[model samples]
Target: MESKTVLYIILASIVALGIVVFQYIYKQKAKSKIYLLLAFLRFIGIFGLLLLLINPQFAQKTYTLEKPNLVILADNSTSVAENGKELNNIISKIKATKELSNRFKITDYKFGSDLNILDSLTFKGKNTNIHNSLSALKDVYAREQMVTLILSDGNQTIGEDYSYFKAERNNTIYSMVLGDTTKYKDISVGPIQTNKYAFLKNKFPLETYVSYQGNTPVSVFVSVKMNGKIVHRENLKLNSDVNFKAISIQVDANSVGIKNLEVKVSPLAEERNIKNNRRSTSIEVIDEKTKIALVSDILHPDLGALKKAIESNEQREVSIFKSSASKNVLEDVDLFIFYQPTAKFKQSFDFAKSKNANTFIITGSQTDYTFINNSNIGIEIENGYPQQEIFGLLNNAFTKYDTASFDLTDFPPLISDAGPILITSPFETLLGTQIKGLNVQQPLLSVIDENSSKRALLLGENLWKWRVQTYRNTNEFINFDEFIGNLIRYLTSSKNKSRLNVDYEKVYQGSSNAVITATYFDEAFLFDQNAKIRIQVTNKEAQKSQTSPMVLKNGYFEADLTNLVAGEYEFIVSVEKESKTAKGTFVISEFDMENQFVSSDNLKMEKLAVNSGGKVFYPSQIEDLINDLSTNKAYVPTEKGTENIVSLIDFKKLLAIIIIAFTAEWFIRKYNGLI
Candidate 1:
């Protein structure tokens, strides 16, 4: 189509014609028409090949009609369907509405613990999560002109408040409120809060919140039960119609294992729903104290600070001593805190290593790099210089454990030597180094896993200043105290160097689906899928047990144990071939999340609809909902135009034509004895 292309075509044709005329009918002539036919075929074949090399494009236009989406998101949890017949009738009317079906693409989703696409409701979910349901609706209808209809009681037993849910799209939302809004005469026990661990023979405090709703004065008794036996009891009086009171009681830990404790509030007269009258929890009891030996060369404030922080944990007993005091005390310790190891303390360091104790080495201005370099502690200072002030930079990629709730950027600078270090092991850096407010790619706090040992290194000193600065900014030492506590917990915990490792929470709520995950390693300690793992779970009190095989998933093994009831359970994980074993205990507490409250929250639903530019309707107003959807101008069908392009070089028929033209010319010349 361009003039340049036309000129190229003419030139190719002229060259092709000259060759064909001379070759076919030069002084000795064939048939007159045969000469013209040969030249024409030759020109066509050559010109077609040249055109193909140009690689042109062909396009086609198409039109599509897409109806706007009418999504009906239903809460399938048990609370929403307390009145089942009424809910079913509302659903039937919405489904049978002919006007909605004719105008939009209607979709149904049932959400509770999870979301599913089904035409009917079962109402078997143990919990209702309104926030998650709305979030799922936004994700499922992202690209459509969506009009979402929600049907729920507005009772969120889990997740955050849905009234604060921000819409992800410019879609309209309408809600049909369910459940009775009238408050009933009830007494309930809220979630219990207490310490997770207690030392043997020590009494730990437990706090429980009691809620009452009634016009009459109520007298309720709160009791704590351990292993189905009452340990403590108290009585309280409520005068207000709706009031909440926190009851405190102390329980003694006499045994050393996982102790199952239950806190219950006596139900009042004429109380029909008694599921929320009680809640259960579990606490771990340890008989042996965690002995932490802090060894230093001098009496500095940093030494005193370390001892004070570690002792704040009631379960730990910290002992301070000089590095040269004696090696006898190190024999019975579980953890060693070494501050600024020098050449003179080489023997003390060797003695700690010989006993296979977990060690935390703190480097400072007085550290002897040459002595530490040859200690085989998985860290080496490559070069040394004068001291520098560097702030702590947290490593976002650290996955060994969770960091405490504190901002590392605001902490004061720590003093460390201006030197480079070489870490020749598998390490995770908890905190990196920042100089002059610029982050440097170096480790300030790191952990190393080498040769079946756990080690930690803090590459700076003057950690006392961090505590002082933290208190000045926040008016409290809670952040600094928690950071140090978490670090000690990580160091003192047992390291699982076995070929098979099982990961599960020590405590689970009954309202959730409990899942256990595991990993298998080969002889080289790398993850291997070919290994087979199985687990046998036993109820400690019931004396009943069941074994289940784990299925391989995403390079690990997993098993679902959501069917287990509330009780203390012990699990044994084993590999049949390797004859390895791992044992642990987990407790499932009675959740009672849905039964905590039954009244509907109509105000929340009203806010949701108004904020999203729509109207709220009661369950009986389903017909009105259909009429509003049909008449709304924004919820109309959409038309889209699409254009598709294809390349000429990809046309197989064109290539075949070019090939046949050349083949026919060769055959014709051969038949005429001009080959």
Candidate 2:
């Protein structure tokens, strides 16, 4: 309490005492034993009430001992079990150690593809990710005194190498080697590289690296098979000096739809792990092709750039023509690209409107703004000025299609007529304009979907410069080409427009979770929040079927099919209280990534231990690990203290005493006829 508060408390006590004395001794006519009792009660009651009003607080300090944390991470993957190593006995021994338990705070965890609290171990995980588990524990125990113990074979198949992982804090890591550290004669077929989509009746390239682990020369036959029939085969020879070979094969896409292919390498006779000798993949063969026409009166380099980008995809073809060409040119054209449209292109624009064809319009200084505004193409420019350079700023809220991968931050700007541009129809802007390093609230590239027809408008020219800059930054042209190809595909696609859409992959690994997502829209094509969706999946081989509802998450419905076995499955997604459904098929290959390793990765395990200031020990040396942990001088308990201020008003007992004293005085006075 401060000096002012102490002084006020003393004055209150003095006043309380004076009131008691004057009423009982000085002002009374006679003194009695009852008067003495009354005087004492009054003093106590008055003083207690005054104390409550003052509400003085007392400080309290508390001390506690905080022990260091000992986190034990046990491997629960199939690889550990297949190597004939059990971790339960070791974990039980550590838990039973009384000295360690009394000195440290122990926590138990199990990890395979992910990390979780320790439970009954089954060792049935199909994939191992050692780096992910360690990284998670490092984050959970950051900036604290901690010691971690990892028990595993270090055979990870699905994550980055664990040896290179660096800890963000000062932590001790000890590893227990659990498998036979022997390198056997083995042959594996991946990691393979190939395209996911192919054109029908065309050849697609598939490349793979075939490796051998032995001391002698070896020859293997690499074969590609489709639908259980061999389509291509080649023989490769490798020796101890050259233990790996890059094999490239061209496979023909004969039919339409998805094609599942198997790439296998002939294994050695002494190979103990044959699970990795073959790999499975799928490709979708498309039979439909799009034909685009670029109608422009002037011959510019931008025309050639656009044509090359569109033709990068074998499924699309572009043809350039003069605006004065006859009407027959528009008959078979799926899409029309009007470049800097002027008075000469009025007939072409009229024909496109009459046919209700999708169109992409590009504007520049040469463009006839009066003719374009009068054409009633859903866009109008008012009070146009001289041409100026405008840079592009990507709009992150654009949901019409994916533009996240395009890096347009530093691209060169385009020349456009500076003015207030207006669109009479609903549109979504993909890129906003930036003028002279200042962001202008205007659209540079936008798409419009009205009257069942799609149209895209670019209010600038010199787009070829952006493509050139992309190549300079990335050392390739695929990024720019793919962006243009996706834009053209969205405009020219002829699929029936429905309110419900489903997205999923056609192929999935057996160890991965296969997820199917869906979106439902109302009659106005806005996202419907009250819609309930369900999925019915059927196994094509076993003829078994199951139905379940999809959970709504982040404005979309998702269904997980991780429990399904390896096989071909067909599914249908339907919306409740509506006549909407989507059907699709997918294949799950039977591949166990855990079974690919012949032995434990001992070198990586040692490196992880050494980098984290610890050592590696085998299962036979488990006792040494425990003793080392117990005697480590750095891992010790520390003292922690906390302080709090407690107020006297918070005590209920004090208030009870005050009430009792006042009541006793009132009852005594009333009983004596002084009421």
Candidate 3:
């Protein structure tokens, strides 16, 4: 079929018909029908030339079906701010341009705290989540051949990994990075937990953390201050790999209430940011010490020695229960010690009546060897006692000794003729290494009843002899009191009662939506219910949940970080147990990577041009682009090309000319020409 350009060509045909009529009228005296026909043929040629002027071409079928797809994408996270660049606000600025809107059939999307089509935009959301926004893009344009435009700060806080977004691209993705990238160091102090109030005068553990870039510097001093006065300060050296530094401080709090604790570290010379060098935490001080119960056999030197030893150095409540005499005592002591009970095992259970107290059983100077031989304490004495003393094992989980002086294997096996005592079965051996216990010839102190829940400390020789023999070295053993203090500190220290630590010292703006990650190592860290985490602002009292159904991921258990507010929030994250919860304090700060945003020197719209399959030209060369697009799309319409037949018939100028020629023809023939 022939193609026509413009309704003008059709109007030309009407003019040609009028020419045929005019020729017939002027040559009325000579009957020239062939001349009129030739004139009509010439008019057709003129109309054909006019079609050529419009420059029509056949629309090529590139594929079986022409499917046009449109993709809409936007930044959904809070970190998209362009730092000082102010480029994020340009999204609104660009919308005001009339030229861009008129150029294409557009679909718009916006993201801030959540994914949404950008019918409206407000500056009130918390932060942006990029992963969810991308997923929304996939869902909305799933079936279309799409070109996606992403507006973000490149700070992605969601997704298993971020490389997936960058590596694989099934569709054309145009990234319009909204922020500039730069570096800034910030330190912040989180909330302090004052609930399980700890106050033991001049020193208590004040937990806080330090955040710095990797390998930034070393040799910084950290100080703890209370109420505008400095209390404790320690010099510290740092490594780059140590992004976090959690230090337990010795603080002095006189009484209970809201008290400010300032954990300050000396600023590094190269530390570009110094505002976060000092962190402030709050605490409620209460005068309380750990409670201890000691069950001794009779009045001995060890009591006075222990009392003075514990009193001068340690902080604890000590109650002496001479089990051979009294049965009545105070309830709910923290630790229970049974010292060579002359009475019997009945007193062991009686002293442990307070369910909360931890039990510690010691070998006595006159341990009922006859009864112990028949009982199951994991060790049994020989019928004829060995002339020499021996020591065998030296592992904390297994044995409690610095070094083995005398091997217990030379004495006798822990198993008696009755049964096994301090050891496991006759078949099994418990050792992480091959240095076996000397049980082959004669086993020493072994864990007989493996069900021994209470940790036992066994000594082969009566260590009281060492206490008496200490006068030899006046300088070395000058202070016999110090040795006993170390023993008591290890025995009574509530190291097990410490909290799982979460610290927030420094965070960048880009890392705002990131989860507050912490480091923890439980001898056995496992899952439990009734676990809740409370995060409050560093200065303000606002709390949110950090609880997740699952506490572990990739071997490390984690608490969820969703629905958290922005700013430096102090967090009292805790794991609840049967008695008291293990708690740790940390700070969480909103990171806006756009805070580093800078104005780019290169403003070329390469991404915008490529995604749209258009070529980018300098501002001076934009005319070529506009002209080319207009030239390519100009006269092309419906049938994917020029509609020749419709154009030929509907030309208005040609219709008016035809009507005038018909009217003149009718007037000449009816009134003058034919008559």
Name the top TM-score candidate.
2
Cα error, candidate 2, residue 351 (Å): 16
Worst 10 residues of 1 by lDDT: 1-10
What local lDDT does model 3 show for residue 358? 41
Q: How high a TM-score does candidate 1 get?
A: 0.64
lDDT of 3: 0.47
Model 3 residue 248 lDDT?
68
Q: Tens digits of per-residue lDDT for model 1 on 1-675?
A: 446656765776676666666766674477677666766677667767766775555567799888888888788877866766787787678778888887888888888877788667888788878788788878877876788888888888778898878875667888888888777888888887878788898998888898888878889998989888999888889867447888788889988987778889998888867888999888887777789988888767888778777877767788887778677767888888889888888877888788777889898888888888999776789546878899998777789888746566467788989488788989899999999978888899988877656789998888888888878888877778788888888878876467888898777878266778899888898998887789999998999999998889998899888888887888998886878888988888877576677588888988988888888999778778889988877777778889887664555776787788888887887887866
Per-prediction CA RMSD (Å):
11.9, 10.5, 18.1
Give all TM-scores, in the order shown. 0.64, 0.70, 0.45
In model 1, which residue pairs have backbone atoms overlapping below 3 Å?
Answer: none
lDDT per residue, candidate 2, 184-289, as tens digits?
Answer: 9888887656787788879999888888888888888999888778998889888878988887888898889877788899989888889899988777787767
**Per-model CA lDDT versus the true structure:** 0.81, 0.86, 0.47
Q: Candidate 3: which stretches are off by over 4 Å?
A: 1-108, 112-145, 152-291, 299-320, 324-330, 344-348, 353-358, 369-452, 455-461, 465-675
Model 1 lDDT at residue 68:
86
**Any idea what lDDT model 2 has?**
0.86
User: Model 1, stretches more than 4 Å misplaced?
Assistant: 1-31, 39-59, 84-89, 119-122, 214-219, 228-232, 239-242, 256-258, 270-272, 289-506, 511-513, 517-524, 527-529, 551-557, 645-650, 666-675
CA displacement after TM-score superposition, residue 46 of candidate 2 (Å)? 2.2
